[model samples]
Target: MLTQDIRQSAPVTPTQAGTVATLMIEEETTISDAPLFVPEDIGAGLLLLGLLLSPKPPKER
Candidate 1:
């Protein structure tokens, strides 16, 4: 009886673990496909470029 219970429970744990892993993978993919992150990255790059190319103030002697 104990062996039968262990065998049954073993399958259940793996099935649940697989489901959780699949959900996590799907969520990660969804996050990666989000449109907001790309624009933010692009905006940051443009801002950095602008800052780098901007003229500096003349230093007072």
Candidate 2:
């Protein structure tokens, strides 16, 4: 198989001491690009839904 040949050609070796690998990721976003609904928005929506769906007390005669 191709994988078997690759493995045989380049054998795996343990990392050497004092060796460090650094991975840096950079993301760029503009102010115009914003999420439609954030956590606070979802929480507020749930709270409003609960208030609207809650039972109401009876009125006095």
Candidate 3:
């Protein structure tokens, strides 16, 4: 899929903007088999971890 197509289809958040832009540019310019860890993955993972670890509010009586 084209970078523009991907960008249009995916929702871009403020935190993910940089990562998404970099990925889009790379996708548009190159075809490589390099093994890399994108910042977005780490950000998502951390967000998930934070959500999982946060305490839930007590139920109303």
Rank by lDDT, descending?
3, 1, 2
lDDT string, candidate 1, 1-61, tens digits = 4555443444458888999989877753334544555577589889999999999989999
The Cα local distance difference test for each model comes to 0.75, 0.62, 0.81
lDDT (Cα) of model 2: 0.62
Give stretches of model 1 more than 4 Å off: 1-38
lDDT of 2 at 45: 84
Better of 1 and 3 by lDDT: 3
Model 2 clash pairs are none
* RMSD after Cα superposition, model 3: 23.0
At residue 6, what lDDT does model 1 achieve? 40
Alpha-carbon TM-score of each model against the true structure = 0.32, 0.30, 0.32
Q: How far does residue 25 in candidate 2 sit from its true spot (Å)?
A: 15
Q: 6-55 in candidate 3: lDDT tens per residue? A: 43567768879988778877755567788888888689889999999999
Give per-residue lDDT, candidate 1, residue 17: 90
lDDT of 1: 0.75
How does candidate 1 fare on TM-score? 0.32
